[model samples]
Target chain A: MARLTLDRTRQQALSVSVATGAYGISFGALSVAAGLDVWQTCALSLLVFSGGSQFAFVGVIGAGGGAGAAVATSAFLGLRNGFYGVGLAPVLRPMRGWRKAWAAQVTIDESTAVALAQPAEDLPARRAGFWWTGVGVFVAWNAITLLGALLGSRIGDPADWGLDAAAAAAFLALVWPRLAHRRARAVAAASSLLALALTPVAPPGVPVLAAALVAIAAGWGHPRPEEVPE
Target chain B: MSAYAWMWVAIVAAGVLSWATKHAGHSVPESWLENPRVHRIAAFVTVALLSALVAVQTFASGRSLVVDARVAALAVAAVLLWRRAPFIVVVVAAAGVAAGLRALGWG
Candidate 1:
């Protein structure tokens, strides 16, 4: 599966980084409007480093929910990053000490997704994808967050720019290539519908978490096609 | 504690939880995770969850389903992606369509 060139991976990683990073402008503005000062909003991006969770935090707060709910929601949304870390652990193995600590900080959605999209055997490309994507997103997201926070509501509606769609578009692009398998397609459909149906009732992150169960459930039935040996 | 005080507490708590989750994955035994079952779940969970995120982001507004330009953009983006267009093209086309629709007040 080592099909993606190092150069190609770098290009993909960088492009997605900039696109998703620019979307951070919207997050910064929203967080401030939600009553977080510029520094606190910046701190969230600096410290949390997970865009979905960061947005989930401000969204809850903007709605006047208590900080407890906000934290809980964001934390739950962030649980996906942990799973990403797990999936990539083998590929990113042998990390130690401060390097490991730093890696933990940046083991985010875009990084892991880009890295995993690499062929499993292309270790160098995988590592390159992970590090470049993570670092690229970090620098760009933080820099833009600072800019957006300072500008505040003057940035207008980031949503209207279709940035809200941009993030989704990036993720969809990642999933698009992997949809070749029947099981993958089935699981995607089931999970998406589950999440949609639950969106009206379940709290923000719960639907996604519940949808994750579909993967484990599918595993029981499909029996790992790769293991069967063609 | 005021909500502000709790906010501080919660932020620290969330950071710790997130960090721990990252580290724990590294420490997990390789053999334990090597099960193909584990691999399948790990791989597909991302796809499912990501699509789920997109769904909620584009269509849901506080427990209610609403169709808007975001959804329309997503559909166009899907077409671009399926045709193997480059990343920027897919995103730009998607956003352009959504923006065009909104400008016309269709979304």
Candidate 2:
């Protein structure tokens, strides 16, 4: 039974990694269209290694926002990765020094989700799930990103190839799973409207930052039962 | 600095900041992250940011808000997502719809 469970965990991790990694093509194409050269685009994947932050960075820069705004936007999008690290530390305990640092680097949404979904007492399975998903996604995401950047550069006007629309779709796909609760839905609606309103008045990065305030306001109050329906 | 130089800085800075944020969580006290308020805010912030990106990417073109091929493409993408299509399929469909619309000069 122990061996059977381990195999199941590995299977889950590999599937999740492939599904998540496939999205890297869109990121690569979008980043290149946003005006990063192929090498810079690949570098973003290698170093930053967060899909949402990398996309937001390109989105801000592609829209002509200053470097400060781009960095700020990307950084804000990266906050959840930190939270993931906190959540995973206990499950994958005994990590120290280089191992701890490496674990932190791989502590992303998929890894956290997969790790936490394992049977609570099954530390070995949880660790396997986390490492497999994290490393698998890292390799697949970077390799696919490079391919997309190469194709994106040769594709001429991004709009002509529909890459811009694909970027929006990618964002929508990401947030869709998270919008299970009423409060989240309300926040998403308000944030999008505020962002739309500010798009014309404020600079590119400012609107997204402003939209974040809606969430902060919604969340600052004491947590209610309905706050976390998931 | 030239735009090229600035971009390189932004890329490196963003990467460093990302790693720092991820690392901080591991080092911070568990109680700090366990706070319900912090958790709620983080969850909501993610939804808000992604939704905002979708709106901006689909509707905004520089200082002006324009309706173009992207809108139609996103509409199609939404249906595919609603029906539970795979991620890559949804993306490819959106791109195809937009490309088709632009080719026909209807967007």
Candidate 3:
């Protein structure tokens, strides 16, 4: 059983890393398409390392939004990462040292979710899963981003072939599997409706922010105790 | 603000915000982190955020909400997910559906 669990964790880490990495290619291609140089795009990928925020920043810049607006937008979208850390803190509790810094840098959505889903007795294994998945996604994503930026220069307009759709499709692929309950379904519907309604009234990232808030409210409305089995 | 300058500021802000949140629960007494209520909220918040993100991606573009090939593909993916299909299969099938629709000039 232990061996089986280990294998399952490894497989989950590998799957998430690959899926997350594949989406980075779109970011690279789109960043350059948005008028950023390869170095700029790579730097953003390396430093920002958050797909949604990077997309929002570039999208805002591409639309000729001011720098302040772009920064504000990106910051808003990044709020979820903060929440991710809070969720994973108990499951993958870090010991002080360089490990803590490494944990902080890699505390992304997939890593947190995978870690938190592990059994309570398997904390160490869970942390390993989180680290492996996070590092794997980060390294693979940046590498693909570089490749995409170089290839995008010659690929003409990405919009023609629906590269944007590719990114959305990739995200959907990650998200589709998580809606396992009625409450989750309802929250998703509410948040999406709110975002759709606000899309025309807000800027690129603002609708996402509005949706996030609505989802949070929905979630807060129904607080299920944590003792419930996974 | 210059583009690079603003980018740097945003990066710094994100880094700081991320660090603060990760360390907040840890810095507090062990009691707070151990609270059942806290854990519940954390779990629910993550789900909520993820749901919101998925919804936004499926239904909303930059400034409009239109039913397109992506939506159809999402429906297919959702069905497959409900049926407990493998993750890769679900994603590939959805992407294939979308790509096929685009090829047919329906997107």
Candidate 4:
């Protein structure tokens, strides 16, 4: 029984990992097309490793901002991942010494979501899923990023071929699966609307930050009586 | 900002900030995670964050707001998602619709 559970967990992790990792190609190609060099592009993937932040950083650079401004903006956007780590602490096995750092480094969106989605009975399996997905995504993302960066130089223009759309498409692919409830739907709608409204007024990353604030405000009040069932 | 002359101090700063933010939550006391207030805050924060991302992707182009094929495709995707279409199909259909529109010069 344990072996079967482990197998299932591994499969789940691999699937999520592949899906998340494949999107790195878009990031690599787009970042290079946005005017970054191969080394800078790879460094973003290796060090930043967060898609939203990477996009923000490159977007800022593309728009001719100083590197300092771009980095600050990306850092602001990446703060949410820290909150995910806090939420996952209870379910994640307690680790001491070096393992804790490893766990922290790998605590990303896909891993957190997959681990949290696991059944309570499959705690060990869930842990495996989290770790495997994180490691798999990290490896695949860097590798694919390298390939995309190299290929991007040869391609005339990524935008002309719609390569630029891949990142947004990939994000939608991940997001569509989670809109299973009314609250989620409502939150998504509200946040998207807020962002759309703010985009013209704010800097590159500011809209995202604004949308997050809106969602936080919406979450302040508990779901209405009709929204929750006894 | 020449490629080589661009100061890396900002990059290093950003990396430090990103790492700190990403790691801060893990260091929070365990009790906070279990607190209902914190849970509510986190939930709302997530919604807002996602909304913001979706909005920017759909509407913003550099410094301006413009509706185009991508926005149209996103509208289609939202409808499909609401209809409970499979995720893969939703993405493919939306991208196809947008790409086709652009190719046809309607976007």
Candidate 2 lDDT? 0.77
lDDT: worst 10-residue window of model 3 chain A: A221-230
* Number of backbone-clashing residue pairs for each candidate, in the order shown: 1, 0, 0, 0
**Candidate number with greatest lDDT:** 1
Positional deviation of residue B67's Cα in model 3 after best superposition, in angstroms: 1.3
Measured with C-alpha atoms, the lDDT of residue A1 in candidate 4 is 88
Show pairs that collide, candidate 2: none
Tens-place lDDT per residue, model 1, B1-107, is 67666776766776776677666765667786778767667767777776677677678877889898888899998888778888778877877888788888887
Residues A46-83 of candidate 1: C-alpha lDDT, one tens digit per residue:
88888878998889889999887887888888887777
Measured by DockQ, the strongest candidate is: 1
Q: Which pairs of residues have clashing backbones in candidate 1?
A: A1-A119
| Candidate 4 chain A, run of 10 with poorest lDDT | A158-167
- Report the number of the highest-TM-score candidate: 1
Task: Label model 3 with its docking quality class.
Answer: acceptable
For candidate 1 chain A, which ten residues in a row score worst on lDDT? A221-230
Q: Give stretches of model 3 more than 4 Å off.
A: A116-125, A156-185, A207-230, B1-31
Candidate 2: stretches off by over 4 Å: A1-44, A50-141, A144-159, B1-14, B25-28, B80-89
Q: A95 in model 4: Cα distance from truth in Å?
A: 5.0
Cα error, candidate 2, residue B19 (Å): 1.9
| lDDT (10s digit) by residue, model 2, range A1-230 | 88977887787677667656766787889998888899899989988888878988999889988889989988887876765665566677656799887787787766765565466467898889889988988998999899889887554555677767766775576467667678878888899899899988885467766766887788889757566422
User: A55, model 4: CA deviation in Å?
Assistant: 3.7
**Across residues A92-207, which tens digit of lDDT does each residue of candidate 4 receive?**
74765567766776776667655654554677876876788778888988887888888875644334343334335545544554455687677778878777777778766677
Worst 10 residues of 4 chain B by lDDT: B43-52
